[model samples]
Target: MRTSLNLKKVSIALLVVGCIVVIIIAWLNSNRYLPFQGAETTSSGSLKAVEKRLAKLKQAGEKPTLEQLADAFQPLGLIDAHNHNASSSRYLSMLDVWEEYHIDKVVLFGDISEPSAIGTDAAAWKAYQSSPDQFLPFFSGFDLHDEGSLDVIRDNLEKGYFGLGEIAGASTYSPIVSLAYWKASDPMDGFLPEIYDLIATYKAPILLHIDPPNGLPILKLEQALEAHPNTTFIFAHMNAYNSPEEIDRLLGIYPNLYADFFAGFSVYNPDGGGHPEIFIPIMKKYPDRFILSSDSGYGIESEEQAIDAMYRILYLLDDPALAKKIAHDNMMAIIQAQPATMTQLSAIQELASKNGKAYNYDNLSKLEAGKILADAEKG
Candidate 1:
């Protein structure tokens, strides 16, 4: 009888122990997958530890590559607010890279002068048609003095262009470089009233590449902002690498002025090993106004590398929510605010169907006459 009782006790103990083991395993699995939840304490500790390590690295004169910096944090998806579709070949390759890196959306712009070049307005529209869900196409501003400029802008808008930009301002125009040829007419120039009116009327966003000398553009921009409160204006390259305090000041005053981080400024100094101390407080102060982008041009090997660079810089902020807002959410909110119409959708579909293959633009010369002609003939 004693032996029988001891055996029953042993069986009960085994069952209890087994139940405990299962519970522990389940808890670990849940924590492993959902690290963001109930892991705030751990996450904060990790961030501090990383900061310390980065400081040490900076002191030792060791700079980490973007990929190395990115690997230290959990992978988060991104939305690029400012990017160019350089060429049909480059853009198609970038799409593959974007997919690999979990980049959900990209705001693509084209050059007005080179409409048929792989990186011009035509390429952006084609890419958008190919992947309507992935691209937000913005038409480049033409010579404001030209009579045909307004007509071109209106035509693109009617054909489903999301916005207007990469408009050149005094800062971006340079006589020395062949590429920096497009110059914005002086802000006092008479042509802006009609352009601003059209943008406001259509409820479209305008991205301006302004880097004023002696704050000349700021006054002009302020006037434009005050005049067209309904239109959203994105300052390219953080107003030509302005100080964070200036960014804060501008953002505080103008609700419509949004800035994108694209230039290689000291604030984004990758060699510093982490996010700049000055930028963090400013970003926190105006979390919604700042957006992250890879203004990497045609020379980049892949879009994934560019995104990884963005992620690396973003992770340095150490605030996941703020990171999310800058990396993806802010841009998404802007795009969602101006939803695409049925006409736009139908047009995109038609273009996609007509293009057939997305990445066939290996040679620029052949694309205009051969591929486009063949597609048209078939139609």
Candidate 2:
């Protein structure tokens, strides 16, 4: 009887051990598969003890409402490419912040190089993953210019990042900030090729805010094109850094070269040449190549402005086909390029409807614009 008892005990111990091994393997696999949901790290590299607090928030289930989102005139689907709420304190948790605008998706990125800005960014990453319906995250950890940046980029790509972004001040124009930023760092070193190579390998696009004197437009862009011939590059707010002539030249030269026109703050400056007329010729000339971005989501002031402006610009184009492509076709092409689920296809179809007939460029009708915005909000 004693021998029988010992055998039974041993069997139980073995079963427990096997279960533990399986659990450990599962945990390790989860970490590898889910970097966004890993233990949150601070911008300065310290891990915070938010386990209990997060649990409380999760259990309480405070579902942030649309009304909690600040009021905005435009629908949320009207996305702007790069927005940090003008660097405001309220910028944190902006994924929910934009709900009122009815924005279907926004590209959210964080500075991997910030000394004190990492923790919140990790939370933002988790939030997007938890409810991808609410946010389409553009993962960013660090710049290739800095140390360990390549690993960060590669790991993000492996984890299913939308693309790389917000590489500050490397554009074609010479903004004062871009100038100061470049002066502080050396971007042209060996890092450039490695960054471009990884970006190419991932088949991801690079988001940039480059200006001329601060960064080389023609030469640097050419090198990037040569290295990552397959990577689709989307230059946001093609300010002075990327001149009209160069946009035409590079986009013409490389099928992968592209740009978005959302930097409304600068592109729509009173003294600046507006995005539409200045670039519509190119947009029309290369309809399949470019996208129309709001460059928005900062705050009350910029809401709907980019879309409103797009209306005027397309109206100016006076070509039904050109206007339709910018308003819906090009963006649809990008989304459709990927293999989306039936649900994703349906959602995009509705969004494309909104973009297509929302406004007739030649007619200049605010009522038509209001109807589209209203429909999206209802959606």
Candidate 3:
């Protein structure tokens, strides 16, 4: 009778162990902590809660394997500066990547931010909640008109947004987008400076979208750089080069400035592709300053195929490793560069003193999408 009892007790213990292992496996495989909250499978779901859970999972050892992350995600470190699920031909999300390309993480910056300004920016950001894992989010165009802009930004930052807009500030134009810039303050009223002040208050970096014959969009950009040297600036669609000489000129002066080629060629010459002769050499010369952007969401072939296209630089460059850095590594480091920030005053100190006071950043209004950019180039 004693022997029989021992066998029954052993069976119960074995069953309990099996159940525990199974639960752990399931948790690790599917980041299913809060019942997969925030991932609505549709675009309209609420994700703020899910974002919190994910942070905890990473802290806990329940994170997914790198290969698991890569199953749909390519290169372990790739963050596309330009991507969207709404307002474009393709609508790729994190799940789609997991199902198709195995993309682990994707940084999402809503092409636009303030909804009151035609809401194009907000709509772009709202669409990406469908897949959060692959997307590290950045806030886009904040409406200075609304006093709530800065507060809303702080709330979102507390929620875990990575950076600010692909700051294609004033004068960014595209066929799909009509506005060359956001509804910036009236250049004459000194509203532009006020907006920057708001950004400084929150302590976020702004991505600038204008490239120019004058080197950068406004003389004020350099001033902004100098005065707020601590703020990191990203110049997207780097087609500002009216010629090779312009490229050399811009890079020569702005050591703090960072550039990317994703939109540089795609929007300008769809039929032929990017002008590597000009952009490639520049990227090679400053590999540390460039970042990769598929520019399109995973939903469209153009978006999905963007990574492969950028990756092709490996064959084109004299040093494949550096080419890979420009295409993939540089951005990864930037994304990881979350230097400790405690007091707001300390954050402001980081801005480089590039003579922001000299620039005449008076009354420039940010235009609505497709409104100003219809003829304006992405550079």
Best by lDDT: 1
Q: Which pairs in model 1 have colliding backbones?
A: 86-119, 87-118
Per residue, candidate 3 scores C-alpha lDDT tens digits across 1-379 of 9999999999999999999999999876555221211111212122233233334534666534433333312333345556544333334434465345433345555455345323434444444343334455566656645566666656544334456665445453433333534444222112435546545544445565563425334466667666655556676556434444665565677775677556324433453245555466776777788776666522225554555544443324434345446645665555544422232222222221332222111211111111112112221
Candidate 1: residue 261 lDDT (0-100): 73
lDDT string for model 2 (39-145, tens) is: 11122211122233333434666742223221221211334445433223434445443554444445555442243224434544554454444333454445445
- Alpha-carbon lDDT, every model: 0.61, 0.49, 0.47
Model 2 spans with C-alpha error above 4 angstroms:
1-77, 85-102, 111-123, 169-190, 213-217, 240-242, 263-267, 297-304, 314-379
Winner on TM-score between 1 and 2 is 1
Please give the distance, in angstroms, between residue 189's alpha carbon in candidate 2 and its true position after superposition.
3.6
Q: List ranges where model 3 is wrong by over 4 Å.
A: 1-76, 86-104, 111-133, 145-148, 176-182, 185-203, 211-216, 240-244, 263-274, 297-301, 339-379
| 2 or 3, greater by lDDT | 2
Model 1 lDDT per residue over 324-363, tens place? 6777667666654553433444444466677763422222
Q: Assess the local accuracy of residue 275 in candidate 3 as a C-alpha lDDT between 0 and 100.
A: 56
lDDT winner between 1 and 3, please give it. 1
